[model samples]
Target: MTKIEKKNLAWGYLFIAPAIIGLTLFIVAPMIFSFIISFTDWDMITSFKWIGLTNYQTIFTDDIDFWNSIKVTFIFAIVQVPCVQIFSFLLANLLNSKVKGVSIFRTLFYIPSILPFVAVAILWMFIYNPDFGLLNQFLGFFHIPPQDWLVSNKLVIPSLVIMAMWMGGGAMIISLAGLQGVPNYLYEAVEMDGGGRIHKFWYVTVPMMSPIIFFNAVMNLIGVMQAFNEAYIMTQGGPDKHTYFYLYMIYQAAFKEGHMGYASALAWILFVILVIVTLLVFRFSRNLIYYEAEVK
Candidate 1:
């Protein structure tokens, strides 16, 4: 390589060296270790012994709770991710419009997202309490009978979904930034073509904001799929394991039951599932995600 080109490459590597080191030490090493651990039986008390594929086989064939956890995670992902994304996008659009005290409102909405997850989960736990909780009291005014939220198997997942949506304002702020970055000239040109609000939005806003939407969708998908803290704090996977998400189950296996090998296998399975889902999203988004260069 040319001397200047080599220097430029050296500078680039220097700039990125810290990040590379951090990832290798914190992420890559742990991941490799975890994969190796998945093939052995280890309880933190005894030496790990190789067990072949028994742990994985048990998860697929014998562990009913494993399957149930998968079902719950799938349902949570299906329901919560789309709802959170749509709500966040709509809120972003509203905040993006010319409005008084928009900044104050944005800050208020985003506070929940910035708060620690444990705090948020605990706060929601109180709000969802069947007796003397705000939600129950509000419903009581309409003569609706108090219903167990976190305690009810039928309602636990949905309750958690609501909590997730409430704290989704951080994502809304990001979407608003994306919305603001969209060139106003696109809207102006569409208006010059005699386009109405719906037409302008359909042709301009959605197409331009699609990349942001795809990003948020993928993030929310990963978040919901690996949901643990909410279910752990709120219901403890209670009410018949109704809210027991995949990651929660993994925790229970590894920490609670001392089945580290089984939990590691489950973790790998989750990793594969997330990879496949992310790839599918990118594949499908190719046709939908719009680039400015493609528009003309």
Candidate 2:
């Protein structure tokens, strides 16, 4: 309990005060308010009316649309997350190699990641246009008929999944950083043990990269669950609501449908799902993630 120690501790707390305040104001406070709002039937124009668990009951028991949205979101997470991760990892591996114009290639690949989701959705709409789009034009060369991508119920989810990969450069960059951190001696040792490229990758690179892969997978899972802009901007949850994502449902409830309290309930439900899913991933990943520090 030295005077100088107390003064230094106070200074440290002062330095971190802004971050604490920001977190409370922006994240913690809103979460608490949203939880309270979820319990009441409060459309923006109407006075708040306490409804208890009616919203939850309706969503679980009666709302086919809500269940469909849940199904769609689950499918999106399952398919999109793995695809994006694998693609990004491969791209990172390619970019990690020493090659001419590699920096330019890296920049080109990463450019899509920085583009706004709204702009990406709009851009893809042109590409998916059946009449005279680039995709159809390409298919014409192969003598295949042009397909209505986003307009077809069966194809819409897949189309969205494909479009989701556009921003995978962020994950690629993270994978690249992880790759760089792998010690050169490990690969050299693997090579000395009659290990070929595949062997080295599977035995050395994969285990070393597991931590990064796990990190990227968890983050992508969260983001994909909350996907909105693509479904909203591109498809508007169209083609018989096949592309309807959960966040789009929430947006419609909160803003377009004027069901703010219902939307708040949906938001809280989604938050719980996100937490559960994330925890499940972490729990299962216990045996998979490898740390160099843990080996010794």
Candidate 3:
């Protein structure tokens, strides 16, 4: 209200103006458009016609593929999220140790995460090829029969989960940084209290890293829920739609089926699902996450 206070507020707004503009133009505007589209019946070729709740009704009742996509998405998120999080956490912990060439090893591990999705998909396609692929060749040495990975309905999603974990190097790096931020004094103190490795990890490392772990879990969950590129490039949602994730199904509705309204509705559903899941995660984290100062 005072002149000095007004001047400070003006300066703060000026500093954040670019970010505000970018968010309005890119994120907020598109979300509004998408919500509007969800209520209409429009192909790109035709004018949008308002058809309230039709898209939503069809997805819940008439669209079998929509249900299938939801099921697949749920399964993928459930399996991949925890597996990748645990693996990345363990890897970060291992890499946090005082080892020789840790930087080189870290770089090598992280290269996959930086690779373009198209390149990674193609590379994995070869690796998962049924005949004469690296995986089959490796199995041959032990006299195990060659298996169809991407083409098998039972195996395709799991294979994708494995590929996702392999390239989850970015999350691992974040967890490593979190691990390093844990005070060494806490570990030493635990040891003096007659704690062993597991005790120290349970009391010190886990509590200290709780916030980062929660962050990584939420991020990975959101990413897996929107999985499309791998399903598109590798399986094409084939093997009887076993890998038909939600986003890929949305793409099909929009582009292949010429059902833009339906696609928009699906996108809205996915957005809602993500928001609910994230909120649930935050609710659950109240019991799990332990700030260092609060613990004392």
Q: Pick by lDDT: which candidate is best?
A: 3
Tens digit of per-residue lDDT, candidate 3, span 103-209: 99899888999999999999988998898789989999999999999988889878998999999899999999998888889999998999999998888888889
How far out, in Å, is residue 273 in model 1?
0.7
lDDT of 1 at 197: 90
lDDT per residue as tens, model 2, 1-296: 89999999999999999999999999999999889988889888869999999988888898898999999889888999999999999999999999999999999999999998778877889999999888889999999999999899888878887877878999999999999999999999988988999988899889999999999999999999998887878888888887789999999999998888899999999999999999999998899889989964
Enumerate residue pairs that collide in model 2: none
Error of 2 at 77 (Å): 1.0
Query: Global CA lDDT of candidate 1, please?
Result: 0.90
Cα lDDT of all candidates, in order?
A: 0.90, 0.90, 0.91
- Per-prediction TM-score: 0.94, 0.97, 0.95
Taking the candidates one at a time, how many backbone clashes does each contain?
0, 0, 0
Say what the RMSD of model 3 is. Answer: 1.7
Ten residues in a row with the worst lDDT in model 2?
Answer: 157-166
Worst 10 residues of 3 by lDDT: 287-296
Model 1, range 1-296, lDDT digits (tens) per residue? 99999999999999999999999999999899889999999997899999999999988999999889988889999999999999999889888888788899889888888899998888888888898788999999999999999898788878988998899987898899999999989899998999999997799889999989988999999888898997787788888988888999999999999989888999999999999999998988798888777854
